[model samples]
Target: MVLNYIWIGFFVIAFIIALIKVIIGGDTEIFTAIMNSTFDSSKTAFEISLGLTGVLALWLGIMKIGENSGLINALARFLSPVLCRLFPDIPKGHPVLGSIFMNMSAN
Candidate 1:
């Protein structure tokens, strides 16, 4: 929620500054520049996501294979001692432990 306010504040500040520039400095193209930059940034972001698509797909595919072939379970069992120590509040065989292990494995 705090992040939302901060993001809104950023836009509000930019708009106020841009308005001042337009009124006092007679900079008519400020909003156009802002819009162009926004579009360019979004395009670049989309491109980055497109570039990562293959790698993301392969990673999820490998994880799925490991799950189906029991490698994930084997890994969880192998790391159970350390994980159990790290997460003392979680019961030994809790379902959440599997997800925790999977998330850790992703990292």
Candidate 2:
């Protein structure tokens, strides 16, 4: 998948940059610094996810309400025409058109 390539690319780029720093600048601590950066980045990502948990739950509840109230279906119907215009190849009144509207409403 694309995510696999992205992870591999990040590692490759980081390794190459660290190698260059060590070879050209004679920075013996480059690897240590690189490892520290990786740890810090992961820690930051975890902290951000933790912070977002409450917001995510709130949004999920709001989405449930919208779905139960028929607001999402109304939105999908309203957007269906626009989506058809944007994706003319999908054909008007197609099942995929409804799905596209649903996806947009969800977002």
Candidate 3:
């Protein structure tokens, strides 16, 4: 019975309830508290992303090197048997498979 409509309905119901709480219930601080929490959450996410920038760059550089050296393609070939079983639709030796292997290693 669960559908996309139900997901949106939950948000809509919560929004209405929040509005009622702020207006009729005189819970004026709720909006301020929500805004403060939202800002704090975004700030924390930004800091984490910033901290990971160096690691992300290092992985991307390694992937680029592997691509240039054809190591990724070699790995893809080595893993082809398992990859073939996991992804039956992709043809053997497909360039996409090499890219997939690169992403897998980068992750």
Candidate 4:
């Protein structure tokens, strides 16, 4: 919710600055530049994602293998004691403790 307001404020400020550039400073290409940048950024993002798809799939496959082989669970159990010490407020056998171990193992 706060992020939505931040994004709106960002675009509003950008529009005001671009309006001043076009109307007061006679910089007619301000809007064109902004449009070009937006399109270019999206295109670049898409290309990067496309290129990384294979790598992402490979890593996910590896994670699945670890999960199937019980390595992830083993790691979770191994780290549970340390996590318990670090997050003593969370009980040792709580679901969140397991989640914390799983999250750490994933990373």
Models 1 onward score TM values of 0.79, 0.60, 0.59, 0.70
Tens digits of per-residue lDDT, candidate 3, 1-88, equal 5788898897688678889998899998877777788699999999999989988898889788989999889999999998999899
Better of 1 and 4 by lDDT: 1
lDDT of 1 by residue, 20-96 (tens): 99999999999999999999999999999998998999999999998888787777777888889999998876767
Output the TM-score of candidate 2.
0.60
Clashing residue pairs for model 4: none
The lowest-lDDT stretch of 10 consecutive residues in candidate 3 is: 29-38
Error of 1 at 76 (Å): 1.4
The per-residue C-alpha lDDT of model 4 at residue 54 equals 83
Better of 1 and 2 by TM-score: 1
Clashes of each: 0, 0, 0, 0
Worst 10 residues of 2 by lDDT: 93-102
Residue pairs with backbone atoms closer than 3 Å in model 2 (clashes): none
Candidate 3 residue spans exceeding 4 A from truth: 1-15, 23-25, 84-94
Q: Judged by TM-score relative to the true structure, which candidate is superior, 2 or 4? A: 4
Best-to-worst ranking by lDDT: 1, 3, 4, 2
The models' CA-based lDDT, in order, is: 0.89, 0.80, 0.87, 0.82
Q: State the lDDT at 83 in candidate 4.
A: 83
